[model samples]
Target: MTYIRTVLGDIEPADLGPTYAHEHLVIDGGRPVELYPDFDLSDVDRAVAELAPARDLGLACVVDAMPCSAGRNVRKLVEISRRSGVHVIAPSGLHLAKYYAADLWSERGSVDELAERFRADIEDGIDEHDYLGPVVERTEYLAGVMKIAGSEPSLTPRERRVYEAAASAHRTTGSPILTHCSEGLGALEQVRLLADHGVDPRHVTLSHTDKVIDRGYHREILATGAFVEYDQGFRWKAGVDNGTLTLLAWLFEDGYGDQLMLGMDAARQGYWTTYGGEPGMTFLLGEFAAAMRERGIGDDAQAALFVRNPARAYAFAPVAVTAG
Candidate 1:
């Protein structure tokens, strides 16, 4: 039977209620922290504290989008989930090139080799050293999602390699694919590439696509049958036209609600109130739910965006086996 894998363990899709499709719950001491110190979300207590209010507001799950060698602390993720009483789905794949060092192993590994590492994280367990050290000591926590990122203008050679590996791992292990679309560009290209690599469109979700507001562009993306994650609901400036909300209305009116999902993508500590930030993690369920209702999005569409769509998009695809 298909199940939604969490950091603690797997659960029925119906139990995944009110999930944020993309989020950053931990970024402990990686290249991301070196470049942007605010990305250092190593404090387990603070993370539990930050998620407390959201959990109280019915936030049942969050997909931790940080992948390998980029400050993915699976142990801390498990601890946060245990303390906060929230299901957390960690990832196993790569992020943007800028998030890594110049001579990282991820840059040198072949597609098959990268796929092996990622598959191990899903089928076996996550490496305790986060795949940085010589010895790989995997813990009990397994990754639930395969994350791949593409650059703007087009996919770079390195990005393409990672995408191919992610597709391989997804095909073998049936883990759903979640991707990073830079500035919301390259989403259609990403979907097309993953499709070319034999990834089921129903099991793929392109993140940050709300950064682009054109209805036609979004329509083209939804036409391919891939899920689009919108995380900028709280980022738009006050008094200015809220492009994300407008795009949501357009897509919902056009009857593409099943392929749309929501997230906070709160990668920095400054985005959390426990770290003294505004809006906090509860904005999506509390404030944005009100905004969506005000825009005539209604209850069913909100459930699709937050509950039903994520339940389907994030669940493991059925892996096929041939009789030898």
Candidate 2:
């Protein structure tokens, strides 16, 4: 049977009910913290409390965007999953280069080295210390997805190496590759690079593209058969038309529901209601669902967006390559 890996363990695809394709549930300490203190999600109790309402609203799973060496705490993720009862799929890939120092593994390591580390995270276990220390102690929890990022307007040489490494990991492990499309640009190039690396377009998800509300741009990206994840539903300002909702309406009209996924991407604590944030974690199914239904997006479309699309987009590929 097809299965999706989670921090808790490997589970059947049927168990991934109502999944959020991209998010940041834990960010204890990292470059993000230094740049923005609000990115600190080191509190397990706070995260568990924040997800409570979303869980009650049928938030069965969340694909945590924080990967290894970028504030990805496997222990805390497992704890949150246990406490909140939300299936958590932790990433085994790299984040943007800014999240790490210049001499770190992602910058200095060879593609083979990077690929092997990712494979270990997928097949063996994620490093307990996020691979920052000399002695790497791995836990039982395994990573479920691969993540990579591209700079706005272009991909740097180092970013290319990271992309190749992520593709290699995906090739060996069959894990779906999630991406950070910087400011929603470079998606087409990211998809092209992954395709050239022999990574199936169907096994990719370009995130933050909701920041670009142009329906034509979305159509270009989705036409590649790669999923475009929308997580800016709550960030759009008032007075102007809700671009996120408007884009969703366009996607529904254009029959692109199957190629879409949804999430909060609430990397900062200020985005959580438990942390005095406004919309909180329940914004998608709570507020967005209501808005969608009113716009002719029925239950079928919602299911396709939140459930079926994630099941297919995040599911392991047809066959797993034996070596990294």
Candidate 3:
């Protein structure tokens, strides 16, 4: 028997190849869009189209952090992966608490209940989609990681609940988690909480750290050996480039580039539509290379930033799947 072991249970880790560390297969605020009123791309169909470039670029996997009601497009995602020859990982925890509808949260009994839902997503499969609708069997749908996020200040109760559930899930099932922190405060606190609950900091990722640019915070978090994700490809309002340059330079100088991960975090239709610049991963990767080249960072450093570092942090073993 092929018994694959990880923080998240044992399974075949096939399908994931040349993966982007983060992405969204389908995200609908589910609100009426004032723009593109006639635009009708069902979540699955849209995911199929959005991923075309990744496939063409020889990207074999993408971890989609859509989570539960917000972007649990798993059925669609599986279909797309089968068609496009790409592996897609979906989130099974809470998104931003603000995105949590009050009626849903209030009606829910406690954080444990929410966690149970996540477990079901992982263990039982999302009910909205079945084989006919696009879902693979629950056993076939394995989440490589969980995901969570918080705001600028301290974490909210809802966010804390999500983290707690993530921690519990990690303990019970051994899945790692990726977090989104817009301002980067309380990341260390969250990391501590996860560690206290028995998760290794090495299995945690603090995303969007480039937004904060706090060197002290960066160093402290890295001390715990957690991965730092820099995902701001959008343009800046101040006419200055996002702090990626400064952050990268500092991390490189501090000898912490080995702990870094990169992504665009652009969940919109295109990269430039959300802001004003080139769109999608292709643009993001090119711009990052250009920026690094201008800064005299070596090609090996670039490969480490994109490849080796992420494999270490995320513990993705592409070879294991093929061997199986």
Candidate 4:
């Protein structure tokens, strides 16, 4: 049966209601924290408290974007899901190069070796040590998504290797893929690269494309059949044209609504209310949602954005089998 995997377990796609396609619920001590202290969101209580209001406001699921060996804590994700009554989908892949150490395993591991590590996370379980230690003790949680990233201007050699490995893992396990399009650049290249590697466009989602406000670029992306996640709705300064909303209006008018999804990508501590921040997680379901309505994004388009698109985008693809 087709299912959307969660930190707790797998669930029917219909059960994953109103999902945030990209988020960072946990960034426990890692290179990210060292470079930016705000990346630390290890406190489960704070995370639970932050998600409570949103959960009550009808937020049902969140695809946590922090992948393995880059501040991902599956145990915390499972706990927050249990406590907040919201399903959390954890990732089992790699992030940008800057987020990892200079000598990280991904820097040297062969594509096959890296694919095995990612596959283990999905099939066996997430490592209790987050793959930091040689001893890998997997917990009950299984990764729901395979995340890969590309640098701006183009994909780095290391990043290309990661994408190749991610595609291999996707082919074997049928897990959906999510990608980080740095500064909203190289999106077309990223899509083409994945397609070359044998990943289905429908099973992939490119994140942060909202950062680029070009309609032509987005049209090309959607034309490829991959989903685009817009998460910069709250970052636009007041008294300025909100590019995110503008893109939404344009795309919806052009009839590409089904190929779109929404998320906060709130990776910093200052983005959450419980962490003493402005426009908390509730911003998406409350303020931005209202804004979407005011901008002529009707109930049908809104439902597709928050519900239908996410269900299909995040659900695992069916693996094809051939008889010898």
| lDDT scores of the candidates, listed in order | 0.93, 0.90, 0.63, 0.93
**What's every prediction's RMSD, in angstroms?**
0.8, 1.5, 5.9, 1.0
User: What clash count goes with each model?
Assistant: 0, 0, 3, 0
lDDT of 3 by residue, 214-273 (tens): 788899989998888877745454578558777888888998878887776756654533
What lDDT does model 2 reach? 0.90
| Cα-based TM-score, every candidate | 0.99, 0.97, 0.79, 0.98
What TM-score does candidate 3 reach? 0.79
lDDT of 4 by residue, 1-324 (tens): 799999888999998899999998999999989999998989999999999999988999999999989899998999999999999999999999898888878788999999999999999999999999989998988999998899999999999899999999999999999999999989899888889999989999999999999999999999999999999999999999999999999999888999999999999999999889978999989999899999999889989999999999999999887677
lDDT of 4 at 177: 93
- Which stretches of model 3 miss by more than 4 angstroms? 1-17, 28-46, 105-107, 129-140, 237-242, 270-277, 316-324
Q: Lowest-lDDT window of 10 residues in candidate 1?
A: 99-108
Candidate 2's C-alpha runs over 4 A off are 320-324
lDDT at 63, model 2: 95
Residue-by-residue lDDT tens digits, candidate 2, 153-212 = 999988898889888888888889999999989999999999999899999999999899
Q: Which ranges of candidate 1 are over 4 A from the true structure?
A: none
Show pairs that collide, candidate 2: none
Candidates ranked by TM-score: 1, 4, 2, 3
Better of 1 and 2 by TM-score: 1
Candidate 4 has which clashing residue pairs, if any? none
> Candidate 1 lDDT, tens digit per residue, 1-324?
899999899999998999999999999998999999999999999999999999888999999999999999999999999999999999999999999887888998999999999999999999999999989999988999998899898999999999999999999999999999999999988998889999979999999999998999999999999999999989999998888899999999898999999999999889999899878999999999998899999999999998999999999998999787
